[model samples]
Target: MGVKKTVFKTFKFILKNRLLFFLILLILLGALSYYYSENYYLHEEDPSSENFLLNYPDGHVVSLEGWVVDVYPGGFKLYIYHHGKDTIFDVRSNTNVSVGDNVFVKGNLDDEKIITAKKVVLKQYWMYIFLLARSALAILIVIILLLRYWKFHLENWEIVRRK
Candidate 1:
């Protein structure tokens, strides 16, 4: 059979078993929500709070304490102190922080090999769009799965009468 026909056949089978399909879907979505919520809650941690520091290992923890220096077109840079040493860290261009605002950043030190920010506390607007898109996709998948189940039941009844 062609690829399209094979896919249709599989979909038909899934639709015919609506209860099973829905149950599996519920489990999948629940797991996804749980995972995403964990990551989302982590974003709420306060960098300036002493309570936050207790969670991270000493050497791995980096604390940047300074006022926002320059808000360039690309990104904002902060001048901070590290054990009497001064250093500059750049927040990506799209961050919502303004110049001259005091802030603290708590993050791990990525070795100088290739710098990558695992988690950035500063406001980034595009994250909302990404989250919305994910929600839309999950909704669409559930709707399609339900429609397939209905189609399978209708087709199955038709086949029985023909026989």
Candidate 2:
């Protein structure tokens, strides 16, 4: 009886706050995706003309730079070309790499000669830097907005006039 009433009350409260729950869920999902994309996602990278994968055997750390020629989505396989040599790079997830985009690949080659990319960074450093700066600015703006939104609610009730 008591437990049932408490459960019903809790359910009703939750139902009344569905919008807040959904907002939290949306924020969580966005944060998770950003975390994965920034830290876990293997982005393709291209550097200078030096071959970072030269003479590297299996299980050895190989770093290479080349243009992304093809990408097989959902398979984590990317076909990159360096000096006319086709190199197979395996990413962790579906990497957004376009053809002719310069990228740097760092990983170890398995027994099958496929480069398992641990970190695939793009050659364009300035672009990523710009993006990071923009993200910081946006975060600052959100913080300011939240501060302003809550600032008006705080009150000091210490002042009083007596006759």
Candidate 3:
């Protein structure tokens, strides 16, 4: 009888603290997801993993996506983001690019750890900023439309469709 009473009290407390209960549930779910998530990138020694450039054999065709950290007359130095560390590689491409540009290169890996790019795609810094601005504007528009069509019911403690 005492155990049942304590369980009932605990249940009542949880029901009264809905926000705290939901927050705890969310944290538990996130922990479970992280625990079960794949960590292919974490294994840098694996040849199949894309996180390390050295995993690929020299003269092998490879495709890499990274940012240009320095630009030279012939090419630029690429900095690949791999698990909080930078994997820098030299790229030789004729495509005009600049430092801070996001680039995708498909090329052969040379013995000197250089990529002789067969094809190069560049995304300028201004284009990335414009993309962020457009995304924020779209989100703002969505929130405005949602509030216009719905309202919170204080008595019920929930959002209801406005008529």
Candidate 4:
């Protein structure tokens, strides 16, 4: 048999086994969703600041606990100990904190020693909708492919038996 025909025959055989095909499809979809969700959560962006730290290349999320250094009208600057490096964060002045108060700030670490605050909490909510949409589309495509394979196998089987 030619290579094309041999490949098609093998594909037919695999599709005829419905349980095996579905099981493989499920595993693949699950793996894709896991990967997407992990990456989505790991790279969330904070939208509170005009200068989003996550927008910077190689920027990372960090938590800094330190005393407020200077409070300005627009924003306040915080001197924080971040990963053994002293860093400054331009925080919104409206934030409920005093200059001498020790506070914990959670945001992205920028190259210019700035942290753009997304939220005070450790968890971020920006990427949740994106991750959900991606995962749903992936699952839908897998299901459609599985259904198409089943239909193709049924049609081919009927033709072979008619001979």
Candidate 5:
């Protein structure tokens, strides 16, 4: 009987403070998400980690996408930034690429950490900016439409359909 009364009281408290309960739930989920993301790239056994890749023998084929840091006569230096284990891949390719350009390279990693690229694909920076602009416009339109159809009732702390 005592356990039943305590359980009932706890349930009543949760119902009375439903907003606080949900806020705490959301925060807990967010914290867990952050923790998982931060550790995901740093795992020792993960193939993407620098330590894991360093153990691989020479002539291993790999695919990488990163920004071109430098452009020289025969090839360019590709800067792959991943979770502070940043690496600059010395890529030897015939593909015409400029500094600050995003490129995807399928290549072989030599013993000296150089990459002999078999294929190089250039990703234009302008296209990315255009995509972001379009997304922002679409999001703005959606927000406007939502506001037109819904009204927030401060008295009840709820969103009600506009009549």
Candidate 6:
């Protein structure tokens, strides 16, 4: 009798505040969508062009990630020594990259083997930091909402399931 009463009370509390439930669901969905878009749906322009490769056999579209050696309004130059070639990429863009910062670039190479950057990814490390912060925020919100409306609080190892 006591278990039945407890279950009934819990169900009543949750069902009475459908709006809160919806809000929690929406926030969880938002966090999930954010992860999805970053991981799966992100699209970047292909730097490889047949014209560039054909016209200049020495240079073509390449993806390079290296330390920024110099910066200018029009573009920045990078130095990659990983392949032991000590290759220099003179990318064309006024990106936020500064000297010594590691960056990823996708661009076409000119006759001189300089890459004219089509896209630049800066501070790749920050992406992971932002993801963690965003997920933590979403979880915190769900916990708060659950405590307020459902009269339920989660511990470190609690699991939630819905009927």
Give all candidates' CA lDDT scores.
Answer: 0.56, 0.61, 0.79, 0.60, 0.79, 0.68
How does model 2 fare in lDDT? Answer: 0.61
lDDT per residue as tens, model 2, 109-160 = 6654466677777744456567789999999999887665544423652333
TM-score of each: 0.29, 0.35, 0.63, 0.33, 0.62, 0.40
Q: What clash count goes with each model?
A: 3, 7, 0, 0, 0, 1
Candidate 3 local distance difference test against the native: 0.79
Residue lDDT tens for model 5, 30-139: 99999987787555332343533456546766667789999898999988876577778789988888888888887777755688888788986776678789999999
The sequence of per-residue lDDT tens digits that candidate 6 reaches over residues 16-35 is 77777678789999999998
Measured by C-alpha RMSD in angstroms, how accurate is candidate 5? Answer: 4.7
Which candidate achieves the best TM-score against the true structure? Answer: 3
| Colliding pairs, model 5 | none
Clashing pairs in 4: none
Q: Which residue pairs in candidate 1 have backbone atoms (N, alpha carbon, C) closer than 3 angstroms, thus clashing?
A: 15-149, 74-93, 75-93
Candidate 5 Cα outliers beyond 4 Å, as residue runs: 1-57
Candidate 5 structure, TM-score to reference: 0.62
Span of ten consecutive residues with least summed lDDT in model 6: 41-50
Q: Mind sharing the TM-score for model 2?
A: 0.35
Clashing pairs in 2: 43-120, 45-103, 45-104, 45-121, 46-102, 46-103, 46-104
Which number leads on lDDT? 3
* C-alpha lDDT of candidate 4 relative to the true structure: 0.60
- The superposed Cα distance between candidate 3 and the true structure at residue 77, in angstroms, equals 0.6
Mind sharing the TM-score for model 6? Answer: 0.40
